[model samples]
Target: MADGASGLGDQARAEAYALPLEDLNPGDPELFRTDTHWPYFERLRAEAPVHWCKESEFGSYWSVTRYNDIMSVDTNHQVFSSGAALGGITIRDARPDLRRPSFIAMDPPKHDVQRKTVSPIVAPANLAVMEPIIRERAGRILDELPVGEVFNWVDRVSIELTTQMLATLFDFPFEERRRLTHWSDVATCLPMPGALCETEDARQAELMECLAVFTDLWNQRVNKPPAGDLVSMMAHSDATRDMTPDEYLGNIILLIVGGNDTTRNSISGGLYALNKFPAEYDKLRANPGLIPNMVPEIIRWQTPLAHMRRTALVDTEIAGQPIAKGDKVVMWYVSGNRDEAVIENPEAFRIDRERPRQHLSFGFGIHRCVGNRLAELQLKIVWEEILKRFRHIEVVAEPKRVRSSFVKGYEELPVVIHA
Candidate 1:
């Protein structure tokens, strides 16, 4: 059932079309885990780009399916709020006692200043400086991989590479960098019986541990001269230096997940997309110069971190569908990225598109991903290094995808390298 860019079989596709429009609930995490959410989104974009669901496990919400409608909702933050107090930015509402404030979940002046503190880490000059370092590390990781034996690419390359980069940015303990990955997974994964943490209390306990470890690092850097790391940047900045413990943990989880999950999943997703569309893989192999363009296209095809939610602060209408005050509006970026009306031949994964960055993966508006440039740089360098070393990194099996709808990523990707 694990698939990306694979055909939804006839029966599955029919089931999606056969559903009563009222029964469509794209927010279901099971649909994502099995990679069968495409047909439902396809139906929505065609039939009701701004559809209403009277009920769902996450409670009733409006789904904005097309590209322009999503843009309208994402950019007009005044009408659509992301305040943590207003239930934050995801479909799942955090328990009242558990919600914490982070810039992505805040609006206006506070969001502006706090975001500025972390923005410099991904600035052009900084990205240029980090490029060679990323390239060198990427080479080392690829060089270490076994050629003939199958291994989980998600663990071996994707996670290791992104975790190393996260450590570099945070100046986190070298050997303990994997802890960042664990914290990120715990932050986003649903607390179901088989998931990372089975209870919200257990999840909170682990997050507290994360806060404790980062608090120690904060102490170390608070008194020292300001340095280049994210930890130091926040410790020195007025906007975030005095954040409450809960607020600090909120931002930490945001940064860890933002910096780790998105890029690592894209790293894994890009490889999976290419393997799924072998013609594109051949195109990449034929023209290594295309890596620059291919990076963004791969991101478009994957659309990691599927949907970002917002709460309507006032009455609004998207695609003529009425949304009242306090309504939860979920922008389906996964669907928008594939809207045929927006991109030419979106269903086809081509490496050399003329306008590869036009997709909505990084989103549009004030809350657009802060570390987006860093992500692109990481992917570009990784692919560049990959093309130099191997003809193909064959996906020997369908990826074992993560269970949550929030984090559209792989838990495992079995693969073997061919020289």
Candidate 2:
């Protein structure tokens, strides 16, 4: 029985390695949903760093798989544009009729101006101010966990903490904070049965409701004195104060997803990964001081946002692959984080790595995540508090992953705490 099982495993591994590059579509939602994307990306990184997919659910797009190649494309925003008008920033081209314009989707002066308007919300000083609140909430959530009983950590811990933080950032109504999670999920999820929304129209309708709710907040903020929250800052800032309704909605979606999904998923992913590598969890337990270092390592391993898509502004060649003007280019940050060339034992999840933050989880250059420092701060505090409270938070089963290529995250993680 053991030999037969070993042979089956060997066959699976061999088939994964033998998957034709032409057949390797890394953007498939099913691959991510089933957590079978690693082998496909590993195969691409090894063989075709800058691979072109002739067809996909999102249509033809070029995949930039290597670490350095992704950096080159990411940093050189001039040649590769992130403009919303040019299909926005996803493998799925923005619908001409349903164009949503946000600053992250803009290039040059506009992107910088609008980004600066909200940057202070996550500025170092502000993060210090927010740290205690985050820690307090994390502690409360951990304290509330049902001892020795199976529970969904994704909902109880990850979503609860991140939703609270998102509410704090927007100064949003605490009771309605789960709305933000719904909106974020709606914005990123594919239109499929059992997903967040089964139709594009349904997704847009929910997002429109999101816009209406935030618009009320925007109005209230604009009429009042400037405050530290993201909505207030945007209302008061010259660059974003006069944004079009669509632009405002787009930015709101960006911030909601940025604030919620990345951190929430990482919180869940970190525990899942540690459980996968128990020795690393033992190392973490042996030295709680490694929490800060381990935070980035977890982010690197989880790669909360799988890929950031850009449009080729001019005909350009990336790693010798010719990319034409107006072509969709996807920088697979997930693959780059695992690229063996840049990271030693890239597949291993080591908390004490020499350079934990060296990976591409938070893309480089001007568009690097503004909330990255804040994200790290929250994760670090959560883990620190977790260590003080529990001996082990055991993952009872494989996590139910979100069925989307963009927002790589968990839908559920069954866990039990052992004190």
Candidate 3:
């Protein structure tokens, strides 16, 4: 079933998307910058949950803003395949062969096997072993925040904790943790036009450099005997039988990028939300048990990753909107988080609000984020540590958002810490 309205011509679709009160110019590439999502997503979700967008740099695509529509696309992976385009998931049309293929972009049976291989490591049983270590690290990170002084939380604390934990999972050498973190940042920030490098050639080189570093790391891990870690689990698992070395390298990059960035974003984003809503902050501080409820509220308020694009495999209609096969349909999680129908007073950030975690920040369906529980765990423990140490935390400077639209939360978040 195609959407009721046939696919409009480029001009008409663009005109339809030209709404008032939008800070973004959908006609420009910045509207779909790979680093950040708020400006464009805020506009689209407010104006058109199912609107069309086109930029000279990235071409045309349909943006799904409604919660139900986004959920439909996310759930119906068959009708809306992750494997549609040759390039990877971002809206920017990546060069087909140059883009690394991860299970994140694979469809069906292949995705199933790959996901299964790594799922056990993140299962409740294994993650239980990590809880104490994670709690200790969280305490150290928060406790070390300069008392009665201002510090940049994003770089100094948030990213450090997330990537360090990921390093532990891979058993990466301590000195190499920062490099792996840098690689994840580069891979996710690819669609940003000049965030890292000026030219496409330079961008491709940087990407390959990250891939090569990851490949070297994976080969070393494979050569060694099995260990009780994610790398060893994947290497020894029967589920990965047909997986080639390249695919392992690709998926390793995927897991690192996925695991590191999103959790880092959640931590920093949670800080932002608390600062944004002092009442909510007060609530959490007064009743630390509210931390559980606050976790979802923070995710909802942050809506960190924004939108993920899925290509229509077969023609389909969603919410009376017709989507053609191969058409790129983007589900705007940021908008879905603010959906009025699903969330009462969606704009309000209330920690005590029931079901605060209902926002589609982790997405839905088969491709829903796998490290979601871990990310939530990190947020919980980090906040617990923060509350135990600091009586008051306030933003000292305006936060800096990433330049790209893909993996977004914060680049610089300076905060004044009070004991």
- Highest TM-score against the true fold, candidate: 1
Q: Which residues of candidate 2, in runs, are more than 4 Å off?
A: 1-15
Please provide TM-scores, in order, for all candidate models, with all chains considered together.
0.98, 0.96, 0.88
By lDDT, highest first, what's the ranking?
A: 1, 2, 3
Q: Which prediction has more favorable lDDT, 1 or 3?
A: 1
Q: Compared with the true structure, what per-residue lDDT tens digits does model 1 show for residues 1-419?
A: 13533455555588899999999899999889888888899999999899888888899989999999999999999999999998999999998888899999999989999999989989999999999999999999999999899899999999999999999999999899999999999999899787899998999999999999999999999999999999999999999999999999999999999999889999999998898888889888888999989989989999988999999999878887889999999999999999999899988888889899998888789999999989999999999999889988899888888887788999999998875
lDDT of 1 at 120: 95
Residues 185-295 of candidate 3: C-alpha lDDT, one tens digit per residue: 766664335476666677667767766765566667677887776777776778763566557667877888788878888888787777777787888888999988888
List where candidate 3 sits over 4 angstroms from the true fold: 1-47, 191-194
- Give me the overall lDDT of model 1: 0.91
The model with the greatest lDDT is 1
Tens-place lDDT per residue, model 2, 1-419, is 01223454455457668767787688998778877777777878888899988899899999999999999999999999999988888888868978788988999889999999998888888888999999999999998889989999999999999999999999999998998888988899888776668899998899899999999999998999999888999899999999999999999999999999889999999998898889999999999999989999999999999999999989989998889998999999999999999999988999999999998888888889989998999999999999999999899877888887888999998888875
Ranked candidates (TM-score, high to low): 1, 2, 3
**Cα deviation in Å at residue 198, candidate 3?**
2.8
Global local distance difference test of model 3: 0.73
> What's the C-alpha lDDT at position 259 in model 3?
85
